[model samples]
Target: MADTEHSSKNVTEVSTDQQSNQSSKVEFSEEEEMLITMVYNLVGERWSLIAGRIPGRTAEEIEKYWNSRHSTSE
Candidate 1:
């Protein structure tokens, strides 16, 4: 009984961790993409300001996304 309970607890903990990991992924909607573009054109590379205009997005996340999409790395 004790081993079974412990195993179930571990499984529950793992499930919770997976949920958190999934939530951490950043998914931008079409509107968000358009907003980012318009905002970027207005204020190039000012990540914090751009982030402020978008809800639920951190400056670091916005900056990373912009760099990944637009960085001139060839």
Candidate 2:
């Protein structure tokens, strides 16, 4: 019983780590970057609007990407 519980816990931890690693890969194509920049300049840090202008990305992802790059500049 203890072995089963411990193995289950280990499996859960590995799955969680894998999920995080998978989601952390936020790649932007050259076109996506250009559109992101255009929308950002036009809208001025309004992440949802910027993201809407560039499909295939959510507001949260846009915000995270923008903040990671430009948050220090602000």
Candidate 3:
């Protein structure tokens, strides 16, 4: 009975770990996709001008943010 309980607990723990990993993977993939779209939309065009038009954004900061976002994505 003790061994059975231990086995069951181990299985539960493994299942939980797998579920957590899967959730994190899905979130990361989604973020990566969104960032890719954002970068594509903002690259080498009027992004700096747009950012400048925004109330409190600098073009350098926007570029840096996009670069950092893209780096993390890879």
Candidate number with greatest TM-score: 2
lDDT of 3 by residue, 1-74 (tens): 99999999999999999997664432224554465456557665455664644445555555555565567642
Better of 1 and 2 by lDDT: 1
| Over 4 Å off, model 3 | 27-74
lDDT of 1 at 48: 95
List lDDT for all candidates, in order: 0.89, 0.84, 0.58
Off by over 4 Å in 2: 71-74
Candidate 2: tens digits of C-alpha lDDT, residues 1-74: 99999999999999999998877678888888888888888888788888887778998888877777677652
For each candidate, give its TM-score against the true structure: 0.64, 0.75, 0.39
Best by lDDT: 1
Model 1, 8-71: lDDT tens digits are 9999999999997775567889999899999999999899999999989999888877777788
The CA lDDT at 43 in model 3 is 60
Which residue segments of model 1 deviate by more than 4 Å? 1-25
Worst 10 residues of 1 by lDDT: 19-28
